[model samples]
Target: MEKTNTVITIGRQFGSAGREIGYKVAKDLGIKLYDKEMLDRAAKESGICQELFETHDEKPTNSFLYSLVMDTYSLGYSSGSYTDMPINHKVFLAQFDAIKKIADEGPCILVGRCADYALEEYDNVLSVFIHADLNARIRRIARIYDLTDAKAKDMINKTDKKRSSYYNYYTNKRWGDAVSYDVSLNSSLLGIDGTAEAIKRLVEIKENNNNKKL
Candidate 1:
């Protein structure tokens, strides 16, 4: 299928092979995939240190910190406001701006960091959530991280919790809720490659529908 001017944003459970599927989809579509690379771009664009983005990447902050950041944003980005804002808020705003900038440039696949919410106003964006059976995720995590099953399960729980908290806090949307995304898929059902192919089909269908409206 020919590529369309669409931005794909993927939200996934820790061990659901979501990132792998995103890579495959981007390769098949001959588009760039933004994940960790987004942090670099955001840091450079926002003039914030790159390490700050990495430190707060997708991690939730306390309510006090949240309030301070929002207040600063509401007051606008004056020198005082920017200086007074917490590092987490600055990192998030930087990433949010970066995501929008990237989408405006062209079609690409963005994994996490609330790209879906960042581009919600864009009609050409597709948001997807990838999940898997807990046992399957445990096995996958264990194999990839070379950890015991028990340790893998712990890692999954912690990572998902942080992701959910961050998403919920940032977007005011429930993370992993089907209602929050255009489509939800179970990676365990079709494997990483199969899932990527399925997403390609969906994107083609969406593009066709979009073309019809034009």
Candidate 2:
């Protein structure tokens, strides 16, 4: 394993195999991978229950009920800044802080949760967006979950929309846009292993070039 502190952030569309690719990349690079485990860390760091993090994971809330119960949720935090924040915002900030701390620790692969935005200022961060054709995603989802094509399509669309809303709400950049990331790859074109190799190649390029211009 190469000794490097580069943090790779993956933004992926639903059923794009982004998490699988990230898993492969992390294994190949001998680094830690954070996905759902981040929720546990954030829950510990923010004093919020793990159930809440799971409930609001990659989900944005814009409801009157959020405002109504905001006070109840705010009492869990000692910080004044988080007092008036909605539950979703508190969750995001907790994850954001956890991401920064994770980056500070060393090399790791973070899938989704706007990790790129959280560590945007760090020179060692490499952000990638993974996407696949709609039909390909639908097929993959259907096969993986044993669902009808139409059901798979619907789930993909809804999940993607939720991720987009969560990302766009928290970050200034648009979600799933190529311009928002250092590099964008289509998993349908190269397959998961191939895409992972592509990202590793990009990492090599960045490492060789003094972490400038991937």
> Which stretches of candidate 1 lie above 4 Å from their native place?
63-65, 68-80
Please give, for residues 1-214, the per-residue lDDT of candidate 2 as tens digits: 3665689999999999999999999999999999998899999998988899999999877776764565565456556656667767778889999999999999999999999999999999899999999999999999999999999999999999999988886788999998999999999999999999999988988898984554
Q: Which ten residues in a row are the worst by lDDT in model 1? A: 67-76
Q: Per-residue lDDT tens digits of candidate 1, residues 10-45?
A: 999999999999999999999999999999999999
TM-score of every model versus the real structure: 0.94, 0.90
C-alpha local distance difference test of each model = 0.93, 0.90
Model 2, backbone clash pairs (residues 3+ apart or across chains), number:
0
Top of the candidates by TM-score: 1
What ranges in model 2 sit over 4 Å off? 64-81, 211-214
